[model samples]
Target: MNTANPQLEGLYLALAAMNRLMVEKQLLTHEEIHETLAETEAAVMKNSALDGQSDSHRKAVAFPIRLLMTANEAAERGGEPTFEDLARQVGRTS
Candidate 1:
């Protein structure tokens, strides 16, 4: 989206890399991460501050959640999945 934060791109990639590391190292299960992602999505969706925001504003805020969700999906499929792959899969293309 045009509202996407350019600076947060790194954070998105970092999240993917961290996910790969976590899975490779057996630090967390995919299901655990998915559960946490769901919890985060729920909490954000319930935030009062988001109630009056425009769609673009809300999507900007949801970028990280979308990234993680797609990244997790890619991981479930097998092999190393980068954040860029997740981004593309989630239609985050520039």
Candidate 2:
């Protein structure tokens, strides 16, 4: 889906609501949320520079979300999960 598409606004809102709920329920810490957002923004910026890109922002946003999902899944599987793990999963090595 296009990240800038107005039709997807509701989806973004819903996801934001769910994240807020997770914070309220202590399912995610404030630091984790902040780091997640930071990583997302970074992905967007990185992907935005692509030439002839049609949906760079959407693709960029998906990168971090995918990383988050992977980290969550790993954690659920009793594996060690960290922001670095998510970053690595998203190919954000430095």
Candidate 3:
């Protein structure tokens, strides 16, 4: 990742580092992160949070989250699909 795109790699690393810092500072814990992810997955799975979001907004948020979730699952099974593969699998393109 750092080899293909330093800027993107830096951003990802920085965000992860910040998240780790929050845990180190006791501002948040992995348990809280897991809970949030579960709650978000529930809401998004049912599209229960579309009350105020426009269709475009929902797709914008949903697509990426869905893509990442799919990737995460695939990773658990020792799969490493490229971003292009993930996009197509998720029925999305940019």
Best candidate (score: TM-score): 1
Q: Which runs in model 1 stand beyond 4 Å of their true positions? A: 1-6, 48-51, 79-85, 92-94
| C-alpha lDDT values of all predictions | 0.71, 0.57, 0.56
Better model by TM-score, 2 or 3? 3
Q: How accurate locally is residue 20 in candidate 3, as Cα lDDT from 0 to 100?
A: 54
Off by over 4 Å in 3: 1-38, 44-51, 92-94
Error of model 1, residue 13, in angstroms: 1.1
As for TM-score, the candidate ahead, 1 or 3, is: 1
Model 2 lDDT at residue 22: 81
- Report the lDDT tens digits of candidate 1 across residue range 1-94: 3337656777777787798789779998888888898788677666735577665665566668877877777777875565566666666441
TM values, all candidates: 0.71, 0.44, 0.48
lDDT of 1 at 9: 72
lDDT of 3 by residue, 2-83 (tens): 1676565345334445545666688876556446655675676567455776656666556645555555444445565666
**Candidate 2: Cα lDDT at 68:** 51
Candidate 2's residue-wise lDDT over 1-94, tens digit each? Answer: 3346645545444554566568668899646866776687566656665544556455555654665555544544556455455556667532
